[model samples]
Target: MVSVLSPAEVKLPDGSSTDFANLDVAATAPCLDVVAEAVADLLPWYGSVHRGAGALAQRSTREYEQARETLYEHLGCGPGDAVVFTRNTTDALNLLAHVLPPGTTVVTFDVEHHANLLPWRTPVRIGTPRSPGEAVATLDEALRQVSGPVLVAVTAASNVTGELWPVRELAEVAHRHGARIAVDAAQLAPHAPVDMAALGADYVALSGHKVYAPFGAGVLAGRADWLDAAPPYLAGGGATAGVSADFAVRWHDGPARHEAGTPNLIGAVALATACRVLAGADLSAEAHLVARLRAGIARLPHVEELRLFDAAAPRVGIVSFAVLGRDPDELSTELGRDHAIGVRTGLFCAHPLTRRLLREAAGRLDPSAEPPGAAIRASLGIGTSEEHVDRLLAVLSAPLFGE
Candidate 1:
């Protein structure tokens, strides 16, 4: 297993310390040992890239550019693709939105994280699907209604339910309708292999923090045509070849057109190193943990594990659930405050999907019961252990947790 930084122990409200079991890898994974080392190794020679004549600057430029190549290959970018680094998935998607053609219509699902949903200019939102097949069919139907230039943005895996989407099918549907597809892979890339060619994706965006390289770097990798033709994302020295006092500027094509000013050298290297480490590593261990966790949750009659598709569908080591008549905020707080465990609670940035699932689950359980506004999400990573899963299950077994 890849070595991750130790999350260490947490202190209880009574000032007692205990081992902290982190089950929130879906929110932000603990840093990898190799990612931290890469950052440390690059820090000593840190220098601004692009124009400096010093050896450090030249070396920095090489490292920064190499990071781009590493991400491009890791993401399965096409030969004509351009890899542009940004702050995170949100920034990356926003850059794409900025560069899109004037009359281009954007299509996305209501299930997206705010990162994917908010950046587009009046995106045509598709309704949530009951199954993977329904997703593709629904998207196809939605696309058929719209005309002109269209870009279909979809999530590779859902952040709320950990359910994997039908990216390849969606890609085929988009192409059949004369549209392009972009993948919001912020959640999927960390848990599974994302091959752009295999998925037939034209663009992909992902964040470093969620991939065990939390130094504030992200990637937007895809076709170069639109990006190359757009104006510079940021009008600054490195992005422009020539500038005049009257505000006229000549912008460089490719990645540099979007990545203006100074780049995050250490962050980029760390992200690239993490991408290399996690690329095709053993995922069965995480799957085993998921199986154990879900099975344990099933034993708790009051607990209802949230899912978007069939009960037997495969997930990426994440389990979101609701306990009868319990507020998720209070449950998550008590878990951390008293039991020294870490998990995420609330809508999880996928507001529409989360709320809809909660409502649907509520209606199934009892028509009189109100839908929960939030849910508890326990996500696993390479660093998560079987003991941690068992520990969480044990804690939840206590009948009067609120009392």
Candidate 2:
């Protein structure tokens, strides 16, 4: 006779029990022991930060603040700028969108994450560009046409194609037309050092999890004035104090305004740790690995399509390629289920870029024709081993495309 069991009693791959149905990054990426140690550092404090005098509270406050400082230095944010802790890249972009003054026109490319695409209420979407110069020209043209206060929002790299956008040149073009720019560095920050000054973007947003932090924390680093003037992103006890019976209240300052409620001290610290770890790794070497992988994948049969946005543009450790006679979902699923290989598939929340790449490869627009089912994106960080690359290539090259 079979015995019924509670959901919590269900065993996992190695015979461990958990309460919830687990899948996705939240479940898979945090199983390592390193993550547990990183999380332990921030759990001892319960008292409110700045709202209490308790030792644990103060320590927690310090930990949170130090994480902010570490992130600031890591991203090259200067004294005149500030770092606002966000839930993720989408939250960061929303904060900026909410703070943008009315009549502020936005210039952005068609090839951006929905987080960047949906925020600007009225955006002048620059169509897909085949080269860095073309990308810059698209931004310049958009900025030239808009007649009000403007912000140019851009992705440093495309999430769908893993193609690097001309962010530096785009920033220059925006400034030349009297507009400031903000970069969606979610894809680039993890792969390289995001130098805001060097890139000349007015603001930059990134995710810790994507950078190997795998925590629920993120950051928005940029100019101080707009953030200081804008209202808080989240409203709660820690965001403001001195609420009156008459209903008036005074809000907190700097990062505190945006970060309400209890801060994730441990998550912040772990993110900081992850950033430091990645910082010391050989970036050039990782880049070389990415190039090698791209080159190798391009050589495979049934790879019917290959497109790298710009030959000369510097990129990070990411490759997105499609195979002929194979569905991306089937490929990604087989890779993971049969071979323990992991990669992301589908539009990657960037429909425009996916369509552009497919159209370019197809040589004609056929909305009805099943364009290659998104892309198979293989991304690497400091911890990525050569074995991962070899495994991915082997899976792709196996005689399974028609199966």
Candidate 3:
């Protein structure tokens, strides 16, 4: 397991301190010790990349460029792929949205997080599917109607439900219909190893924060042809090749074209280090924890596990559920206040899916009550211990939670 800052002590609402069981790893993961060490070592030698003539600048340029290579190898990007650094996943997807050729259609499902759903210029949305085959068929049918260059945008996993999507199958479907695919891997990359070529995805976006390297860094890795043909995402010194006094600027091609301003040197290094480390990481233990958590949820009759497909669908270390007649926010608060357990409560930023799942759960659990607006999510990560999982299960299994 990755060495992350863990079991952090936090003061309870009642003024007592306890080791916090951070079950909200899906939101923002705790920083890895290796990433912190790497950043600390770079602070003294940090300098502007691609501009200064000093030794530090030269070293900084090498380090920054090497970081890009790390990410390239991490994702198994194609020979001509451009690994452009951005603020985070949102910024990366927005960059892709901007660089897409004019009149290109963006086809995506409605169950996507806001980051993937909103960046497109009037996207053609497909309805949510009950199964992976249905999802692939829906995209194929949708693409058959749209005439032009199309980009199929989809998430590798559902943030709200933690169910893994069939990205490879979706990519094949997109290609069969003369369209390319871009994956929003913000949630998937941290939990599983991602390969661009294997998935047949043209573009992949992910954030550092979710990958245990949180310092405001992300990457948009994909084919360079569209990026080179399109205008720069941002205009500044690094992006331009030559600018005359008359302001006739010739822009550079590739990653530098989009990464215009002074880049986040530290953040990039941290992000790259995380990707490199996670490439060979052993997460079977965390998988066990996920199995245990889901099994525990199964024992509680009042708990309705949120999922897009059936329980057999592959997922990460995230388990979201709504309890019968319980307020999700209040449940999260009680866990935090009394048991030092931290869980997330809300729509999980994928509103359409959450609402649909909640409504479906409402019908099955109790038709008399209204649908829940939110759910309680307990996600595991590198630092999550068996004790954390057991404690959370114990709290939810208490007498107050019984039917």
How would the candidate models be sorted by TM-score, starting from the highest? 3, 1, 2
lDDT of 1 by residue, 1-403 (tens): 6888975677789988877888999999889998898888888889978878898998999999999999888888878999999999999999999999888999998888999899899699998788999999999999989999999999998888888988999999999999999999999988888789999999999999999999999989999999998987887877987888997888898898988888888889988999999995776688889999999988775677888899887778789987767787888888888887899999898888888888877776677788787889999997788998998998888654543
Error of model 2, residue 344, in angstroms: 1.5
TM-score of model number 3: 0.97
Q: lDDT for every model? A: 0.88, 0.71, 0.90
lDDT of 2 by residue, 210-310 (tens): 76666687788998878877788787877785688997979877877878888776667777776766676556666776776777776675553335465
Clashes of 1: 0
Instruction: Write down the worst ten-residue block by lDDT for model 1.
Output: 394-403
Candidate 2 TM-score versus the reference: 0.86
The TM-score obtained by model 1 is 0.96
TM-score, one value per model: 0.96, 0.86, 0.97
